[model samples]
Target: MSAQLDRESSENLLSDSRFFFEKIWLNVSLYLAFKIRSVNAPFWVEDTMASSLKPL
Candidate 1:
């Protein structure tokens, strides 16, 4: 019973960490996109990045 609980907890931890990293990645991507736009990056470049990040 204890072993089963441990396994479940570990699984939860793994999923939580994965979620945390994904959130961080999304934030970083958005920040970069904003910077690019502020710098007057080309229309296609911003468009491509926006499209690519959309699926994530």
Candidate 2:
């Protein structure tokens, strides 16, 4: 009984650690994507403006 409980506890700890690492990775990826989008926003706006100014 105690051995089973210990095994269960260890499994839970491993699962929790995996979940924590996955969450951290997701957050970092989202942050990097946001940063890239922000950096490109100005260039996109400029391109749109130039396209709109072109004679149709």
Candidate 3:
């Protein structure tokens, strides 16, 4: 009985830690993607602006 309870508690702790790490990973990936997009956005905007300004 006590052993079973201990096993259940340990499993729960493992799952909780796994969930925490996954959440952190997700946040990190999202942040990196946003940073990459922001970094590229200015070049893209500049190209569009320059092309638009030219007479066809």
Candidate 4:
């Protein structure tokens, strides 16, 4: 009985660890994507501004 409980507890711990790792990975991916988008935004805005000014 004790051995069975130990196995169950270990399995639960592993499952929890997997869930935590997945969450961390998702957060990192989102952060990187946000950073890339922010970095590109100013360049896009500048390009649009330059094109608009060119016709004047």
Give the TM-scores of the predictions, in the order they appear.
Answer: 0.87, 0.66, 0.67, 0.71
Q: What is the C-alpha lDDT of each candidate?
A: 0.93, 0.73, 0.73, 0.74
The stretch of ten residues in a row with the least summed lDDT in candidate 1 is 47-56
Pull out the clashing pairs in model 3.
none
Query: Candidate 4 on 1-56: residue-level lDDT in tens?
Result: 99999999999999999999988976776666566566766777656645644643
Question: How many residue pairs clash in each candidate at the backbone level?
Answer: 0, 0, 0, 0
User: On residues 3-41, what C-alpha lDDT tens digit does candidate 3 reach at each position?
Assistant: 999999999999999999988976776666566566766
Cα error, residue 55 of model 4, in Å, equals 42
Candidate numbers sorted by TM-score from highest down = 1, 4, 3, 2
Better of 1 and 4 by lDDT: 1
| Candidate 2: tens digits of C-alpha lDDT, residues 1-56 | 99999999999999999999988976776666567566766777656644643642
Relative to the true structure, candidate 1 reaches a TM of 0.87
Q: In model 3, what is the error at residue 2, expressed in angstroms?
A: 1.3
- The deviation in Å at residue 8 for candidate 4 is 0.1
**Residue 34 error, candidate 2, Å:** 0.3
Off by over 4 Å in 4: 41-56
User: Best to worst by lDDT, what's the order?
Assistant: 1, 4, 2, 3
Q: Each model's RMSD to truth, in Å?
A: 1.3, 11.5, 11.8, 12.2
